[model samples]
Target: MNYEKGAKEILENIGGKENIAGMTHCATRLRFNLRDTSKADTAAIEAVDGVVNVINKAGQYQILIGTNVPKLYNQMENLVGPKEAGSKDSANNSGSSQGIIGTIFSAISSIFAPLLPALAGSGILRGLLLLFVQLGWLSETNGTYQILSAASMTVFYFLPVLLAITSARRFGADMFLSALIGAALLHPDYIALMGDIGNGATTSFLGIPAVLMNYNSTVVPIILSILIFSYLYKWLDRVIPETLKLVVLPLISIAVMVPVTIIVIGPLGVYGGEIIASAVNWLIARSSILAGIVVGGGWSVLVSLGIHWAVNPIMINNIATSGIDYIVPFTFACNFATIGTALGVFFKAQDRDIKNFSMTGIVTIALSAIIEPTVFGLLVKNKKLFLSQIIGGAVGGAYLGLTNVYTNAFVFGSVTTFPAFVGDTSANFINAMIGLLISLIVGAMIAYFVTKKEERLVKN
Candidate 1:
């Protein structure tokens, strides 16, 4: 597909590599924090071969490039050279233009973006392992089972350590130093201390009572720690003499920050995450149907706008705290609805390019559950198809809510991982499949009829 040519054309239209402030790529898009977004020629960039669409959202200019984004991203990165560490360009641009909410969302998304693949792979593996156990294909006591289970569980068990690295990069802190803080929170000594505290033991750091909690699998505490740590490290780096900075600064920063984190920041972050998760629980408990409709129907829209990341932490918190989450279950419908939209288009569209595009979207969604190619490449361009997706998702979501379906693991909605939705009762599994089918069928029918009506109108 002449990827090198496509990369060159893309850079040329976005004011060349010099216009870029910082850049990153995700599963389906190239995200650029530009010095001046106005310098970008969106139309010209979209016109480039291999590009599907362009979006300006969450303080970044995004180019949708389907599953081949990494290849394109590599080529583009080579052209732009290496990005500097602690680049505050995004913060500056986000503050002035994106406002507080957008800035926060942008930060959260970028911080977690790099971890998605690891998380998704581990999550799917966990789901599959559980399914195997339940199906009696693998015994829980088997050595192979234990090894596979450990492989699946490692990332989640040491989640704080991973978040520490990503958060440090986001906040312009020392990644290794930040990792030390995360490791400290998950230290075996501290974990044992937590057990002692649970069974009546007291501990203190410097006269103040120390409150320790298990930080493994937690989302917020390490990130908050790193954010504060970054500020403290920068301050220490400035004051310490250059000659002494290497040893004294890290020592002092660790001494001060570790205590402060254990005594204060960690608890605050944990409680904060709990509060957010509890609030979502309250809303869903009050009315699961309404919650389902909103999340299911609106999830694709959120994905389109690139702010879906705001809800991810809440889902993770729900899973960590409660062993189950309902938020991700609804988005399954949104994904299948996208597949339905493609099927409708494939059958009705006479244009060979349109048919091929729809065919590709269907295959992409079926295989990886990635719908951006379908969403940005096709759905957004056709209001009728978009409506089909919304209606289908809403219908399917309502059904799931009515039955109170949920997934035990943090799974990316996909055809391969349907077993993740299995519950204690057979009805739970049955209902999930029913809801998925409802979404698919409804979306396909609506899209088909709507396209037919549009064609008739054109003929008339």
Candidate 2:
């Protein structure tokens, strides 16, 4: 990908490292908050070999780079510096000016992007373990299976501790204290206490009636707890004297925050998260086909606008709490449909420019399931290709819904992650493969015909 060359071009066009206040990336774009946006040369950036397209949004100069963004971001960071509060233009980098959606996506990316690589590894491992067990190569009860499952599940089961650290960093809270709060939530005695309460036994913390909610594998609760911690940490630092700040603050903060979290913040967050999960499940239940069609067909629009990740925590929650999720199949369809559209365009486009663009996009999507280059670079520029995407996505999505396909884990885009779709039986894996094949085949055919017809009309 010409890592060093691309990094140099980006820095030069975006007004050098000093112009960058801070930077972050989502699934497909490098979002940079620059001290001065007018200084960037958008034309030069678009001309960069590996660059896709650029946009000014979210209080940042966004450069779309598909799935290879992390590598580019690392190279850029080495060239410039780490993106954080310590940067040169940090004073003007706050998101107050970035509307609601921008702020939301920024926060979502900060927390989830850091965790995706780990989550993908664990999900793939879990899926592999299931595949081996189902094939009778290993018994479900085998010590090996138990150990592997523990390793796989621990990422989720103890996710709060992970989120605490990430959330603490995102919210500018104390990472160690946030982790301490997470540990307290998962402590063995605490689980026992929750079990007792579940069995009709009573419990209290500091004479306050404590809620008996399990925080393991949960998302929102720790976020809320850490939010409260951040505020408390700041407040304590202000009021507490210097001599006793370290010793007295940590002791007092834990004592007060832990009980308040268990009694109030944790339950509230749980309920809110549950409501969101329940609502999505309800929509799927109301009409799986309808939900599938919208999510599958229109998800690209969401991705284009960079808001698709708002659903990340929901997907994770559904799998963690419900044992399976229907949402991913729709996402899977969207990804494959994109690849199909790109392939079809590559085959049909007569112009060398369009042909080369589509071919490159196809290879990228095939390997990493990244659609930005194909999308912004080609699909959006070609109406016929996008039409093919809609048709293909709808077909794949409906197939998933009608056949009851689901996944217990989430992997990023790519057909290679198909193993994660294994269900209690082989039917799920089989159904998903067939549906994906049909979606791609149908989309490509449509795109090919559309291009042929357009060419004939032009000739006539």
Candidate 3:
């Protein structure tokens, strides 16, 4: 269906948007926190033209919208206003800690979902630029490189602003004004002041010992700050008179929050980020191969269940903080193995339609790192190929870990973006290529042999 019609149907079926306390979109779902669940029409929502399915979990009414979710979310938001708010506690909160954990992940998914396209595009550009520079056709010190680098890093440098806008929408705050708070966090004056603090300058805000922390490209601090800002803004809106509200609200919120973040939240956010980074690092430290094996082996299971997003924060945080990541090599191996399995499927298929679809899956995996086509089209229909691919993933993961291979940037796992995994030295790239080759050979051979055997048994 058209975006508008789909959006209208969605709104009407979900109690006309008035029942929505807050709304957020993830990679494939539109999550709604409703003031009253009884108002929703679950059956009609399921039958909406663009909807894939309906889910209710983590105290959310989740409508599956596939990749078009962001588009639908925007259309819905334009129809309604900035969405409404619940009380001090959001309606999504649950009593059990496990449910709360799911809620947090749901929020993270929604917050990051809108940002991925921009990030993916920038990452690709950065990868291409890095490739040209490595080939000696471009120079890092050249103006072209400088311009592209700025383009690539813009979202990262002003990440707070993007997070502020998305999180504000999720938490039911004024998105534009919260973005101003984000802008202020990265203001030149504040950045310059942070430089002084880095150089051992002591600073204070209204007699409070200021604990300044760099906010650029960070995740935790910005989200925390926005959460605080949302409540403060909502509370002020209630107390202040409507006539004076616009003039007084933004002024008071900023005046209070900027200092609050700088002196209190920012430092704590740094601590929180460090803890997150450290935990991921610690896992690999215990034993890279064991870690790789566990991640590689279970990665497919996680992806099949849509739980792989749980690992995204750690990998992104590692790249953001340390400029490198060890956790994602397993992803690389898994992608290569899946591609190999798809190639085997292509050769083994007797049906013309199956053969044509398998070829498409092969191309999809080789270029885009998306293997759902292969997984659903071939592997789920053929058990042997799936198991072989998983085994190949484990083998590749262990070998990469043994070689100490690492990726220096955030990249979707695929051969098309191999340059993204290249490090300061060529060795990293060589090792990764080795891992790729081994994964392909092992997985493809197993799939071929197993398929042949199964076909023979069927004939008999």
Which has the greatest lDDT?
1
Give the Å error, residue 196, model 2.
4.3
Query: What digit string (tens of lDDT, one per residue) describes model 2 on residues 99-182?
Result: 556656666767777788788788888888889988888898899999999998888988899998887776667789889889
Error (Å) of candidate 3 at residue 400 is: 2.3
Quickly count the clashes in candidate 2: 0
Evaluated with TM-score, which candidate comes out highest? Answer: 1
- Number of colliding residue pairs in model 1: 0
Alpha-carbon TM-score of each model against the true structure? 0.94, 0.89, 0.83
Full-model lDDT for every candidate:
0.81, 0.79, 0.73
Q: Model 1 over residues 1-460: C-alpha lDDT tens digits?
A: 5788998999898998878777777778888877778889988888788787888987767898887888988888789875432256655555665667766776787678788888777777777777788788999899988999899878888889999998888877888888888889888887788664542244799799977777878899888899899888878877899999889988987888888888888888988998989999899889999998898889999999888889988887777667688888898988888888778877876777777877888887877888887888777877888999998998899888888888877766788778677666668778899988888888888888777522321100
- How well does model 1 score by local distance difference test? 0.81
The parts of candidate 3 lying over 4 Å away from their true place are: 1-24, 28-98, 195-201, 376-386, 449-460
What's each prediction's clash count? 0, 0, 0
* Model 1: residues with Cα > 4 Å off, grouped in runs: 84-86, 196-202, 453-460
In candidate 1, which residue pairs clash?
none
